[model samples]
Target: MEILHHDVRAHNVMLGINCIVQLTNFETARPQSGGKSWPLKDKDEILRWTAPEKDSSETRYTSECDVFSFGVLLWEIVSQTRPFDKIKNGREVFKKKILIGERPNINMHMKDGHQISVASDNYFKIMTEAWSQEANHRPSMSSICERLRNIFHTNINEDEIEYTENPSKENDITALDPLTQTTTSENILTSNENNVKSKEEILLEKARQYHDAKDYSNAWSIYNNLLESDKGNAEVKFMVGSYLVHGPPYCQNNDIDKAENYLREAADDGYAKAQYLYYQLLFNKAGKYLKLAANQNYTEALYDHGYHLYKGTFERRDPAKGAESLIAAHYQLHNNALGKLNELEKRYAKEKKLKKE
Candidate 1:
């Protein structure tokens, strides 16, 4: 009888008497075929173990999904720790990593001072195969059972195996598949003594990755969550404010009022870039904010403030000071500063030409 254990996790497995292992949690289980599909209303319950496809509204629980969850369970057995233990939001994991085809690290558990044995290697290989992003690419339960039986029958002694060290930067762990690389999310999560990154920083990195990949909705979600967690965080405020101003597709509708409020908060909190952007939002009426940002050596702010001063766009045009600021911006490789300086010269020449006319 083909069965699909819809929910597969370490908690659902039981160790019976005489070392007999039995799987529990039949509440969500159904036959592999000929069952009424259930709607995905409460995905949060199994988001950590479910496959990437399970996040979709139209997807139905399948044997392949169970295989993916089993892969996570296998990792738990080998590592003796929960996957993504520090992360509370499973949806964030799905959006930031899994949906992009990244998986949990297979080698992170190596630091536990365990000897590398053939059985452990085979276990990791099977686990990775089961976690393949494409459901069809994952091995069936029968194939998984065969592999498990082979490992059990091999009778590899752990004591005879030589101890192996955890992977260092020079010797990074590569996945079994040639197409897959070392676990990116694991690398992000791994904290070192020298440069320990906070969870907030990791999320920000994920947000930037999403933005780079053009997954704007996820990026916006992460930023908004960060802001909610820390309302006074100037960096998140600037990011959220900028996103609200531009309003990328699937992010949200543009709300200038909200954008201005966020920008103003960040600006008042002494964020130089936010000060400059806030000035722009105010129709450049707040020259003080622009000047403050330029004083901080903000490249765009220097170029814009200098150009406006040179063009007499302010109450008192100081061509010398403007030229000074433009030169500083040019030294910093501000692309527009050189062009603006050239325009300044052309404008002066035009004035001389008009004198003759």
Candidate 2:
């Protein structure tokens, strides 16, 4: 009857002999009366559990959010695999499809002497109701607990438990015991291992090889594949954006609009490099790309920005701005390059004096 954790993972849940469900992962949990919002930034993970109406700005989350999340957990427990695994970029896109009333498929089987069906329309109805987009329409935590208690009392049987599989293999479905139709641990483990891959490692290796050979086209292709695999992968997104911004040959010939799009995507994903690049590209259109680069905190970006500003390629000739940029460049220069920025600063000062005279 008591809550243990808000970040409940599969390993944290335990069923007791008295049919009591003990939960864990309550690091962020607060009293019901406390007006604290869950500090989650990525809505994608919670989308499947969220009600269709609650997807808006006006609706604030309560324990009902946990209800939605629990429905997904139940689905995972019954199905033996993560929901929407077959659907690429599932987390990012699940909310849109769920709002349209798309439901997870369920099937019926026999265990022991009892008939069990995890895919009952009633289950989906309850889940959808719990996840209703409107917070007011969704059931409260106490109500959800009551409903679950009733289901467990009626459906659970200690004797004659059996396991069976769903006819359709769309999801990893399995029956738990000979009498009870639920997913088995062995089947779930097998299905998970068979499906998921180390996408980051795969993409990183491809990029390394391509970059080493200076084959930017192939590098870009690998990065694009990774992006399609996991849109939330900020590192890959940044690499792809960097290639588009500074890549040679094919990428160079690509339209500025396309390059900007990729850079913007990376920037939005929180890649600092992408943010600097995006800022530069925006200013580049107005011949101010160089100055923006110098303003970046990174030394390399500062040097490049200073170089562009001093050259007056993007903006009107301004000796003062050029001198300031060069001074910044001088501070960032390492080893033998120190003289380069200093020399540029000296040259700009002389030019400014001559212009004034």
- Please give the CA lDDT of all the candidate structures: 0.78, 0.60
Kindly list the per-residue Cα lDDT of model 1 for residues 37-67, writing each as its tens digit.
5544445646778788876767877889989
- Kindly report which residue pairs in candidate 1 clash with one another: none
lDDT of 2 by residue, 1-357 (tens): 334134443445788876557876555566666555566454465455555555675765456666666666667666766556676664555655667766565442234647545534455556667656555677776566556644443344434233343245446333524543434655566666655445455456757777788866656656766777677777776777677666575354445676688778878877898899889888766455444555675566555555656666666665456555556656666342356567777888798799999
Per candidate, the number of residue pairs that clash is: 0, 27
Instruction: Evaluate model 1: give its lDDT.
Output: 0.78
- The RMSD of every model to the true structure, in order and in angstroms, is 21.3, 21.8
> What's the CA error at residue 270 for candidate 1, in Å?
92
Window of ten residues with lowest summed lDDT in model 1: 155-164
Decoy 2 TM-score against native: 0.34
**Candidate 2 runs further than 4 Å off:** 1-20, 41-43, 88-91, 107-125, 156-357
